[model samples]
Target: MAEEAGARREEAPEETIEDDDGYVEYVPVKKRRLLEQQKLLQRKGQNSSLVEDGRGAAESKPSLLVKASQLKKDQPEISATEQLVRQEKDMIDRLSERKTLMSVRELAKGITYTNPMQTDWRPPSHVRHMSEAECDEIRKQWHILVEGEEIPPPIKNFKDMRFPDPILRKLKEKSITRPTPIQVQGLPVILSGRDMIGIAFTGSGKTLVFVLPLIMLALQEEQSSSLGGGEGPFGLVVCPSRELARQTFDVVQEFTNVLREKNYPELRSMLCIGGIDMRSQLEVVKKGVHIVVATPGRLKDMLAKKKMNLDRCKYLTLDEADRLIDLGFEEDIREVFDHFKAQRQTLLFSATMPKKIQNFAKSALVKPVVVNVGRAGAANLDVIQEVEYVKQEAKIVYLLECLQKTPPPVLIFCENKSDVDDIHEYLLVKGVGAVAIHGGKDQEEREYAIASFKQGKKDVLVATDIASKGLDFPDIQHVINYDMPAEIENYVHRIGRTGRCGKTGIATSFINKNQSETILLDLKHLLKEARQRIPPVLATLDDPMDNVEEVARASGVKGCAYCGGLGHRIGECPKLEHQKSQAIAGTRRDYFGSGGYGGEI
Candidate 1:
């Protein structure tokens, strides 16, 4: 019976098996019965042997087999279900892992890395850099205008104007053959004792416009003095900078020289500036000088010290009025205005008339006549303006190229004193003769630099805006803007350095991508006012990728093969290889090292 039960448990369907409440039981099956019958027949021979032995062993074995089979069959469904659940869980885990990886990859695509120490990063391009060819073209064009174009004939009908013999002789000696438009228009009002505002370009001969009338008035006053000595500041000409004051004083002295030559008494002129001794100026003041040429600050200082009095000043001239207002001199100018009596004649001259200056004029000048000449501080129609886009790093490179290609005797204007020094040093290293001038320089140093530049001892002058107005260097053939001026009028002053006295000259401005749009707009407006034809390329919008690297690649030039160490080629280099090598190895070691190690170690 046990054997039958064991066979039935092994063959039975797994789902029908169960545990008993009181006793374990197995249901009989037809297959199990057949198996039992066969086993019985096969064991018939062994049965007789088993009968002799105990049946206990066989029965025990069958019971054990039945129990083991029942246990395994009971657990089969649970084991299979657990395996299926584990497989499903594993599949979900793998899918989640795959999604995580995709997310990480997507995040990585948008990220970037930056290294602050990397020198390879490109700088924004500067707007003041220009190409050599472009600079030359501009120079050529301006020279043509300066030489070929006839300035509009001076306004006629001033022959009957009354003036002192000394003043007339000086005017005739300087070939004041005909009066300029400003002179023609402004002289009448100035002579009529009416205040006026004169707007003109730098080289439009505006200085003479007021100077001529002031001198005539001073002479008339001197002649009328019964005591043979004029008193109480007969004429006062105030300028923005000490250099401008000195310049005006020099011009006025020229007129005085002509006066003395004609047997007229010397016109006493006092120069009041910061660097010169104030005591000396006070001494001149005590002696009662007829005319005073001074800067605003020094003039104010003198007035405050009570060392000088302007209570009776009849004629007052403010040159570079626009610059004064721009430089925050409004308060100082107003204070100076307060010192003068209301009946005084005030003449205001500026290259441009911005709103601030116009407002200042309204308060300063009484019913002033406004005279605008040569487009009113625009690029002198005589001056040719050309701009080149270049990388700031390559600015020096382009400047050297321009200097090489064009003529010498150039004036280079920088934005600051440090820039002037840097450019001056750079030019010297390149074997280019140059000098630098700035406010930091002492009067003697400044005077020497200007003298050197004017005397042709230096081929290039790198200077701050201090050298912009009134300071004239006659032979300057080119003006290269190492940096753009802050104001449009400053640009006019800088370019005005060249192309003076009816001589054609060139002004080369460097423009880079990083330049301020406000400055560019001002430049555009200035160009339009001058009636210059704008280049189509400059008129177009700049590219976003207009960076320093692109500009450098466009403007950079490899060292000339012929010149070796020099910027020019070997054939063009004035020095031989041995001399060039020695110079580069010794005097220019720092410059070459800055570029990178150049010589063989």
Candidate 2:
């Protein structure tokens, strides 16, 4: 009988066991292991000197009162840390209260002013708006200009801007106390709830210029019970490319989290771009989102499928607006604009404002306040630029030689995907740690490449113009245009990726005659202004547009209506293809009118 009982016990499951209570109970193995760990930790805690006397013997830590008293006496650092935490919590609570109050005021105002088109409604009489001269002085001081209109004065710091306490504290925690030039002028305009066109160089803190105000506006609207009632997002940030959209999404998410931590309503953001599962994005939208950062195509796809809406999207921002337009997103942008019905505020931010961008802004923004930090199409002055007049065939050899001396974290921009891939492969084969990012790569590969580059896992990033604009990797030491961009403005954005946020950086370009002719004058001017070496090849080239002969011939202004010549009028001029064709046709008609060539040759 004893042997049979032993055999039965061996076969029984370990989860259920009989105790002194004479009952069976179930306990998982994981639970048992966790219990063991807890008991071991308790034993160690009790043996440590940090625990106070007279507390329970099994208690693993000191009493709050004891810890506080000791923190005040023996550890000043601990007290200061505790004070900071408390202050952060207190600020969150206070901001929450202020948000609630603002919501109530907005609700009351809505009751009185219900017109949808009344975006120009004035604030109370106590508010004193900045005068034109004052605004101009502020702009002049910062070397900025706003389109012939007065704006709210620039802020020197977060406190001067009167941002919410939580945001201010968060800024302090991040050690970003001082405002950049763009933020100094851009923030006040955005906060005024007016449409704005902000033009600043890359990495000039343009993201914050729009993001901070969007957060405040969303919070206010949320408190007033204006958002979250619809399937549409309250804010839409349209980026030119998927990488830029992803980076901007991160910034918006970080600020959104800060607002959530302040006890405000939880704000959800969705990043909609290609190279991802469309169904997954749809599901995220279905769950509810308040803000969207997206590329144009994917955003249009979502709209077509009815997965998302922009009916209630009050804040519309175009980051890198020029790039977005140049990349053939203008039609989709217009379509997206048509969906908004509410009193929406539009913001267009770009590094350069060309004529097309200016026209787009005119149609989109209603009397926008244009803010330009520096000359349009100009490169950031912080970069040390170098132009080498290398032959096309020897460009690769020169690049390899340059890499031998260049430091890590170098970014090389090729003109096309093939070159990007070839250069990346060459670098890898040479035992150099390198990664590549371009439109040709799928979403996963692009993400991994960017992640590797950003985290210092990869020392070199070989890319095309797709990585040129609005993708912030702040620590890049050098930018090399292995193949110079076709557009002058692209060169500016490409190099602006380095020398970010007042940090000095180096930018080197390989220029050949074929690539330098059209932009020689502009390149010369840029090099001279940046105090860089102007190559002898570049110095000898004349401006193609400035030559009087070339201008007269190329302007398409027909000096002679008949012959299209500058020396003679239509009647006296010789070479006229249209006139010759017409004269031949008339002779043929006269012959045909008498009797046709008909069957004859």
Candidate 3:
């Protein structure tokens, strides 16, 4: 029975043991081995879970690193873009400021006095005013023949003149008629030992104005042997440019030919300019000459080298006085003037007078007469003025168009040397005949270019303001300002190149939006002072003529008491019919006709 019970228990599924209520437990025969197996299974499961968790953590860490790196890289790009945007804004602001300053400068250009005809104006109290009757009486007196009223006819035989016999003979040979107006007016004053100021337009016989006086002085010095037996120069004529000095010397030489023929010849002159041999000039100075016509820079050098002496200079003339100052030669001019004896007779001749020039005269001139023959501080009336508003980029294109429209032999003025060459090259590329002259070129090149231009080898001469004044290019049909001058007075000089010797011509200025308001104002004032009608397109909102009706209402336009004309004031109206009739008939016939009609009988 015991064996049967044990078998049953063993067979009872190796019966599970109950540790707690209703719980079953199993036991293995190799107890150590079983426990080891169970422990190994549990450790394997736990290791699996740990490995999965570690993989997730590693993957998350890599993603986080990538995101942080991306953020770091993006930060700099954003900052750089911001910096670039700020820089662009700053540049824009600077450009705006420059534009504003330029605008103000243009507005202040050339303002002058208003015309009396256009407005009710009065002369300064110090100035004398004359009535119509008084002016008419003076005109009549000018025509009357008083004792010795007639200029004695020039001596048929030049030998009878007081000049050296040879010079007189030469004058007779050349058939030089009477002295030109400038020569007549300027020579006597200079010879009388008085400081003089000559105001004449270009080619209005101006060369003769100073040249004749210089020649006479030279002649007197030669006759009296006042040169101290050496070639020490007796007179010094300073011009602004080398080309101008050469031109003046050439004219003087021509005049000297006549003097030479009359036996008062042997006049010697030296030319000192740049792009020439300084040693050769020094040699000439050492040899001594009666006259020296030079430019400022070269003259200054020669003076420094002791190659020229001005302490004994008896005559000093500043030709083209306005140009000398305009070119920034004021200091050089002052230095030259200082070198001369204070007692020397100085002549300052200019086409226009500005405040700077007036101040210069006050400092340099000694109580001189201001001889303004034609319109003062204005362009020559004979020059037909025209202006075209164009874009800066299109200037070259427009210049070419203008050249095609106008006749050849045009003088075009630029503001810069590079512009001269640039336009010159552009014209050449367009198969146009053109030449350029500027400060950058050598003296010989300039001379050759000018000569070519003068000889008609080139149809157009492209030059800077350097060629604006003191240049005599006869037969120039037009003067085109490719670049308007910075100053209004420069415009006057530039236009003066045309309308020379009473020959009418055209002056065209190209105006751009960038042009200064000062320049425009000055141009307007200049036109007004010259009695010219300003073009409506150029008229600004402030122009009196723009609101003529308004201005007329404010001023109360009235008819003249003399002629009942709307354009004239009560006291002022030209008697056109009477003046026209009197002008048509010679003065003698007009006087007789007016007086002989219905005699006292």
Which is the leading candidate under lDDT?
2
- For residues 1-601, could you state the per-residue lDDT of candidate 1 as single tens digits? 9998788878964434555765545646985777778788887767666766876355434468899999988874644434534543443344234322111222345322221111111212321243545533543433311111111122233454555566666677776776655665556556666666777767767787777667766666666661123245778998988878888888888887788788876567888888887788877776677788988899889888877777656788889876775565766766676565435777788776543345445544445566666445566666778778779999987888878646778888988898889888988998999988999999888878887887889888898999898667767778888888755667888898777767778888887766665456556656655666655645674422222223223323222221111112222333234444764677655665643566533
Model 3 spans with C-alpha error above 4 angstroms = 1-184, 226-230, 531-533, 544-601
What are the TM-scores, per candidate, against the unseen true structure? 0.62, 0.69, 0.62
Count of steric clashes across candidates, in order: 12, 0, 21
Candidate 1 TM-score, C-alpha based: 0.62
How far is each candidate from the true structure, as Cα RMSD in Å?
Answer: 28.8, 35.7, 28.3
- Model 2: per-residue lDDT, tens digit, 1-601? 9898578667974446676888876777797898789888988776664445645557565789999998778854544434534543353344234322112333445522222222322333323465667656766888886673545667666776767787888888876889988888788777877778888888889998988887776676666764443375878999998899999989888888887888878777889999889887877677667788899999988887777887778888998887776565767877776566556778888886653355445545555778888766667888989888889889877887877555789999999999999899988898889999998889999999999999999999999988988999899879999987766678888999899988988898888866735455557767765678888987787543232333234432222322112232223323333435765876777466543645443
Worst 10 residues of 2 by lDDT: 557-566
In candidate 2, stretches whose alpha carbon ends up further than 4 angstroms from where it belongs are 1-132, 148-150, 226-230, 544-601
Candidate 3 achieves a global lDDT of 0.64
Highest TM-score model number:
2
Error of 2 at 417 (Å): 0.5
lDDT of 1: 0.65
